[model samples]
Target: MNNAPVRTVSDAKRDFYSHHTRPINSIYRRVVDELMVEMHLLSVNVDFAYDPIYALGIVTTFDRFMVGYEPEADKASIFNALCRSIHSTPEHYRGDAEAIKAAVSGMSLDDLKGQFEHLGEGGEGLRGTLAAIAHREKFKYSRPFGIGLYTLVEAVTPPEALKEKEAVETLFKDLASRLNISPDKLQKDVELYRSNMEKFAQAQEVMKDMLAADRKKREERKKAAEAVAEGITEPVAAAPEAGESADSPD
Candidate 1:
């Protein structure tokens, strides 16, 4: 028998917490914890092979969910910890995501769609990976995979094109068909991802407005205090005696 040590989900959680000792903001704590568990479970599964798309999904998910995370530096620390927990490198994931982005940088929506359609011919980057996924008999379809696909679609499609909901839906449905993936599930996952992104943006805007308001209040208080101090030091005209006006003789 081999002497390799066995790893468990608890071990992964412990490792991550140790590295990221700072408390996560309450708003994002659940998301971060769940993501850690999910990654750990997937990493330990024999059937789950790491892929660049999955890496992109993880990175994208973390960045988007962790927007406005306090102690902003902890964001990187948390990500690094999560990757190490799974015995993976953070840089590898980031680099792969960048590579995929670069590969599809200038392609139009149709060009990217064609890449998915004829998967075996798109070469060694995302195209090759898509082909591999398509050929795998028991491909493990996960939320991350859906997110990764969404990321790719967003990269190629123009901002204006994305607004055409029917067109976008048809593109995803067609891609799902070509990949032999579940059309409904893929569509739903992408829709949820987009929805969450919009919510996050709205939440950030609210937070920004609140912070600005708080800062303004503090500044106003500071100005008022300065005015009070100045008033105390400066001489003031005596109040008008009884009913006599200040303009009257006195």
Candidate 2:
């Protein structure tokens, strides 16, 4: 019988919380837990191989979803816990993501696209990785992989170009074809990711408004207390309404 320990999802979850120690805000607790579990499962899969793209996906996903996480310092703790839970190093993931970003930085859309098509000599770094994935018939495709592709496309395309739905669709379609991946699935996954990002942005805006309102109330109460201390009989002037707002911890 094998003597090696068998790791389960619960084990990974336990490890994560142990590392984090501090409580995750209720709003983001589920997101952190689910991400940990997903990473654990993928890491344990026999066919799963860590790659720069996957690293970029993990980094991007965490950064995006964990925006406005309270005690800002805890974000690093949380991410470290996440990577450790999967028996991986956070630095490796971050370094790879940075390298990939640097590779495509200042590259035109066409030049970036060309990296996926040809697997010739001098094909190294991101180009080699993409070509290998394209040629591999049994390559495993996951949601994170799709997100990685989306991240790559977004990195190369101009900000204004992304607003044009048709242009974005055509780019993804062409990429899907080159990679021999299902166009529908890739496109759908990217779209879903984009939709979730939009929802997160809306939620953050709502949270910011709520925090601003709470801060205003607190300031008003403080002024009232000061007035009472001064023995003033008249009502204190209303606090001026300010347009500035603080980020919510949620």
Candidate 3:
């Protein structure tokens, strides 16, 4: 069969003027369209499958869409809202609602750390990722700053910190246990530092480009305004020497 029709949430309402004669088709369309729209609204560039339950299909679609769409920065607040909404749903819709959650639960500490470290350079990619995560659409890593800094420090820390020295050994042991990885392994994996460093470089390059572009625009505008004020058709020539007269004809 051809694809289902796509409709926004606004179009899916039951009203006096309209009734859902083809509830299945209408529901399918509404769900699919909402998912698609939510992706854009949430800044999720990743493509996802569109599957709707046979019953309470509209609600199912929205609940699932909201899972990954929850803003990363405000996860605690939005999650509270999500829990409340999920609890309020009818029992029949609960199962389908829970299914949407399953999709996001796959995000783990490691994955989050990787992405956070990758995007924390505050460059174009990181900025874009943050924008999406802020909207609750993309997967934003939670511990980028912490992980990145830890990796950097561990890379260069003195041997005393790593050896069994009483004062520093305690800190090393704690870090190892908390990270759930061995201290030696963490120190050896210097690539993580390189990766974050590269991200920082890329961000710097993008910023340079942006600044250059802005400068070019400002220069152009200044020239244009000068040209208008001077009643010149093109850019003005260099000014004559202080003592030399323009009318003297060099």
Count of clashing residue pairs in every prediction: 0, 0, 3
On residues 192-225, what C-alpha lDDT tens digit does candidate 1 reach at each position? 9988898889998998787689779999988878
Model 1 reaches what TM-score against the true structure?
A: 0.81
Candidate no. 2 TM-score: 0.82
For residues 1-250, what per-residue lDDT tens digits would candidate 3 score against the true structure?
6564443334323220132122232212443344334432222223322221112233433443233221234323332332233222234434543453332245543443343333324433323333333334322221222233243333345545534346444453454444344555533333343464456556656656766797799999999899888888765578888999877776
Ranking by lDDT: 1, 2, 3
* Stretch of 10 with least lDDT, candidate 3: 48-57
Better of 1 and 3 by lDDT: 1
Candidate 2 runs further than 4 Å off? 1-6, 120-122, 215-250
Candidate 2 C-alpha lDDT tens digits along 1-250: 7667768999998888778898888878888887898888888776777778888888999999888777789999999999988788789889999898888998888889888776644378888888777777677677888888789889988899988988888888998888788989888988899999999999999877877897799999998889888888476555554653444232
Poorest stretch of ten by lDDT in candidate 2: 241-250
Candidate 1 minimal-lDDT segment of 10 residues: 117-126
Deviation from native of the Cα of residue 210 in model 1, angstroms: 3.7
